[model samples]
Target chain A: MSDPTVVPWPRPVSAARPESVLTVDDILVRFQTRDASVTAVDRMTFDVRHGEFISVIGPSGCGKSTLFNVIGGLITPTSGLVTVAGEPIRGPHPAIGMVFQEESTFPWRTVLDNVAFPLEVRGVSRRVRLEKARDVVAMVGLTGFEGHYPSELSGGMRQRVSIARTLASEPKILLMDEPFAALDEQTRLLLGDKVLQIQQTLKQTTLLITHSITEAVQLSDRVVVMSYRPGRLKRIVDIDLPHPRTSEIMTSDAFGHYVAEIWGDLRDEASRGMAEAEASRGART
Target chain B: MSISRADHAPALVGAATLLGLFALLELAIRAGLVDRYVVPPPSDVVASFARIVTEEDIPHRFAQTALEGLGAAVLIALVGIPAGLLLYRHMVLRVAVQSWVAALAAAPLVLAYPLFLVIFGRSAMTIVMMGFISGVAPVTLKTLEGLSATRRVLIDVGRSLKLTPAQQFRLVLLPAAVPTIFVGLRLGLVFALINIVGLEFLINFGGLGQLINELAERYDLAGTYAAIAFVVLVSVLFFLALERTERWLRPGR
Candidate 1:
């Protein structure tokens, strides 16, 4: 069942408010195997406004990544539509850029080259692309390391390079799939801050898939919580916090309330997910 | 400084071990603990190196083996890499032929020298062609392995950027696969060199293998060892060149 309640931005009424940049409208995704077909997502509907930062959180088995693939145009939904700037995505669209959780930086290329890869693929001239890449690199706080390779950088820095690469394309919507899941908590928090800063500066419309309630509360304007397998929107929690958010805001009572609210919604789905996982393992054994 | 020392440790130990083995063989032969005829004393082999260089016209023979091995390497690169790419590109082709190609790598290809001789007529062409077929298997198989081994995330990154198939290959897939492809290349070269030398010895035509055959027939055990040593040198040079090329292609690895 699709939740028809599309959350309105709680900002003060202003003429300068931006329009919707991305829409995930009534989406469903099903994967077929040798013996059975699995429904991963069902009637998933959400809209990311022009400059909103949103996080979608769910249990481990929830179809967050499945939904992300549909939005990124890497996979088509079994039914329904994903659009960027009102254009339906047939395949990977230039208006939608994605940063994966896994290490996606090419080890062979220098930071500058890695950042410039999207522009290069788009056939932008070398000088112009490098110029644009430099700007993104600096925005990601990876300056003075342009000549360095991914192998030389720490894991956090490499993720930054991945982000810079996507930003270099200047997509209308940025999709990040648990981009900090691989990092330690400390590094994740710091990188989360960097992402918040970058989003604030560029006003980039972003959707993040995360399992971390603290992360969702720390970075998102609104957090979409999803149910277990055959993932559906469980609730959309409004994170009514001030801008210029950082780890410091994580100490605020409002932040804790948001985290607790989302966690309260997630705990049951997580237990169901764990029980299903245990049952599957029992069957295999 | 410490890292450089650590890096050179294996090579230094290897050189020392080689020299120690030669010394041990020399001592064993002198003390009559081993037969000196079949395995000539290291000193005798060393002394004959000069004579082979001057009398047997070693330089020309060395050059011939090098050229044959080089030709095989070029052929392997040209045919094997594309074959790998084709296999990767088409699932049906890969499923149908990959196992057979893998079997070819393990097959006793050198025993089929008669067929190559019949086809190419006992010339360097025969040797080159035999080496090519023998070596090409590994290159093709490894190329497929390398391409297949590329991380899924990297391919997704390319797709997310809307890269074309060709762009994905060149910019993402190929570069990511280079180290593995080079492993395939190196293994192919070894196979190619072994076949080239063995075929030259069999047909009694050209290269260090021919000199090796002649020296053995003449019962010039020391000179035979000297020529075999030159064959080893040729193999070393080919590998060294391949290493240089790999480093050039994917630097700072």
Candidate 2:
């Protein structure tokens, strides 16, 4: 079922542009489980431009997260290629920073320490890392909670710490997988605005995978709608909105138009995904 | 900070219960409800303890046993921890050593005491050897477990940061494995103590266990009971000290 809040847009046929920062050429990922070989991502292809915030919206099993993983070099693709800045991504690159969906902040570490982790791993001096970590934490508006461990922080706060950690690494490319999805609606919206603001200020090239249409519309320059199971990119809707976007923009006419258009593109894919999920559930039962 | 009486209650109750049990046993022996020869009265045990403290040359024996145990523990940790890390770093070595180490760990060190005696003789050497054999397994196992269990994400973080293998081990693997290694060390110490005492008793080596054996042979019930109690107290104290040390050393605990 499609969300009733979607406002449809005039369909555009060609939206592809040049000057790509990240290019995924026919990437395929197969998981070798105990019983079966499950294809998570199937020959998916797309390009993200430099300094562009691209949000990938897909059904539950559409391999958006897997794509992010492959991009981050956490997992290797079974077949095909992924290139960043014209170089094949064989393993995790320092230039690419990842913020996971689940709060990945180290529970034993304080917010500042967690942010400093990437720098610490690089053998950067403690004082410099701490200073940079402080700057990033303040950038995420988590200035006062620098000394608080992840366990002491709320989920939204923890996510902010994760973002700060990623930013501390100073990676040109950022890959985030539903970073704000675990947060409450109000917190999600607030964090979403902060993230957009930071990305705008830094001009970071980001690939965000989220199911929230409003989130994608508010933050991303282009929203890539994906189909489930053997996931493929269906369409890329460009949001020509200016940066430093706020919660108010979420209520704008352009925002509504983008949401409706992306929802329309995702409608059939979402139903197919739901049916596949139900059948799989039945099989398991 | 304000102190609470409730916080101290469990400890007080525990101490009182132990004293009460000792008093009950002493009364039973005094009343002829229990055999006085087999089970010494609390007063007699106390007197034996005082004799060990003031009159008998027990301090020398205590120092000897402590030195042997500490030396064995140090040697075991130094040798075993690195060996375990070597296995963790090399898959082929790990596969080759897995079954052998498992078998060695499972086999009782008591069964090997006679072999140690033949090789090292019925001296402190045999006791130390026994202690080393008993303690080494836990340290190796714990080190291996800790090294292998390091988070893949952390490793990736290290790789992304372009850290050398040595640097990665130093910064990430060492800190991550410390808690697990400490657990192994604690278990190894317990095993070493048990083995040391058992070997000393079996081989007539001079330690508290040897004292217990000597007292038992001459039918010195009070002395034997006193020695046994001393051994229990030492073991408890050793473990408590170790627990405190571990708590202090553990980062962010």
Candidate 3:
């Protein structure tokens, strides 16, 4: 059940590497229900440097989301440690923000209010926070949608609002949990491009959990491949592709190479996960 | 455009059907196909309405009934909402108390009005108390449901924002729960209005109910019919105001 691996060449893909901003050490998560005690993420470890874009690619149900929660400090790991800015992360770190897979925009609030929510909670003055929020709203290219409700926006636009809301909070790090999983490829690509552009400007450390190889290659500085349930780090593939990357770069051969390189490590795990799911289904039936 | 039109069609059809039925009834009464004693003619009802306020001094009765209804509504909201928040704050309390709250809704609370009468005595307080006891449960239950059903992801977002528990509730939980809680309020309003007016009618205490009782006792059929019409009008006005308040609390409902 233990799959321990070491990084071969731990060199920064970016020419100038910033200090480590967030660290996860030997993280383990366990859930106890009536029938069984389940291990979701086990002995996983990684670090995110400031301004680094790390995409964690895993098979479905590989505990990528659970890891995100653990990192966000919403769920404390059953064992091991998570730290942010050299502080031992205890609970719901304001320095770290999260974008959920499902849309999390407040339906009752307009786009402006939703984006301003974090700052509003901090008791920031309305005139200043709204001005700041409007800028983030514009940065997300949702300038004219300030008055629109979440119910009025398309799925892609709603996710943009979600991103803007988190970004406006000005967290030092962002933990995005399969943010584009619900959107169609076209919108996903467009949002991915915008995310890259934002990251380039803001230089916030980002950890994105995604299954899409194309997304992983296009947006990440380095892609970490994760094994199936009781998740372990299978490989960390350095994406040597240059910065300020666009969704259109996904068409390039270099991007294809990175995708294929990561997929090679993932294929075995994917098949294993599928078989495990089938066996569990059979048992239930 | 298609979506808005689709949504409004039912309302339009319902309004049209109601008008058609009223017209048919009016015609039947005019043609003497229906007994006037059984059902007053539409014109007579309208004529009675014209004289009701001044002749019966119905403005005072109307105010009295409305005041009691408002009092009952206030009690329902003030007591019910907090009770719901309390129930939802702890799973143990919710588990122990939820069934009792739900059972109160269907427990024939009307039968216990006599006991309330014995306790509160024959007054408006009895009516208001009855309404509060009968109506509070639905609002409380709905509050619990709304709060309990608030999306976990939203709570996570609140956590990530470093919101204190009070701030989380005010900013996140309250807005999310308002729409569902408004539904409970409306249900409670229906119960409160019914109990308040019904208790008045039973006790012959004050307001429209007492007026209707005195009118029927004298066999003043036209005035009785007119007074009951006013009662229906009162209920309609309450519903309209409740609808507006709900929309104000949770806009675009």
Give the TM-scores of the predictions, in the order they appear: 0.95, 0.85, 0.94
TM-score of 3: 0.94
Interface RMSD, every prediction, one decimal place:
0.9, 3.0, 1.4
In candidate 1 chain B, what residue range of length 10 has the lowest lDDT sum?
A: B244-253
User: What are the RMSD figures for all models against the true structure?
Assistant: 4.4, 5.6, 5.3
Q: lDDT of each prediction vs. the true structure? A: 0.91, 0.83, 0.87
lDDT of 3 by residue, A1-285 (tens): 421221123444766667889988999999998999999998988888887899999999999999998898888889999989789999888888899998899988899999999888888999999999999999999999999888889999999999999999998998899999999999999999999888877877899999998998898988888999989988888898765578778778988888888888999999999999999899999
- Report the C-alpha lDDT of model 1 over B13-95, residue by residue, as the tens digit: 99999999999999999999999888999999999999999999999999999999999999999999999999999999999
Q: How accurate is candidate 2 locally (lDDT)?
A: 0.83
Best by DockQ: 1
* Native-referenced Cα lDDT, model 3: 0.87
- Please give the range of 10 consecutive residues that has the lowest summed lDDT in model 3 chain B: B244-253
- Residue A181's lDDT in candidate 1: 94
The segments of candidate 2 whose C-alpha lies over 4 angstroms from its true place after superposition are A1-19, A31-38, A252-254, B1-17, B23-34, B86-100
Model 3: DockQ score: 0.68
Q: Pick the candidate with the highest lDDT.
A: 1
lDDT of 2 by residue, B1-253 (tens): 2366788888989999989999999889889999987788988988888876555467776776777788788888898899889989889999998778867777787888889988998889889888889888888988999889887766665665567889888767876677888888888888888888888788888988888788889888888888878777667776787777666654344
- Judge the docking of candidate 3 as incorrect, acceptable, medium or high: medium
| DockQ for the candidates, in order | 0.75, 0.30, 0.68
Better of 1 and 2 by lDDT: 1
Model 1 Cα displacement at B106 (Å)? 1.6
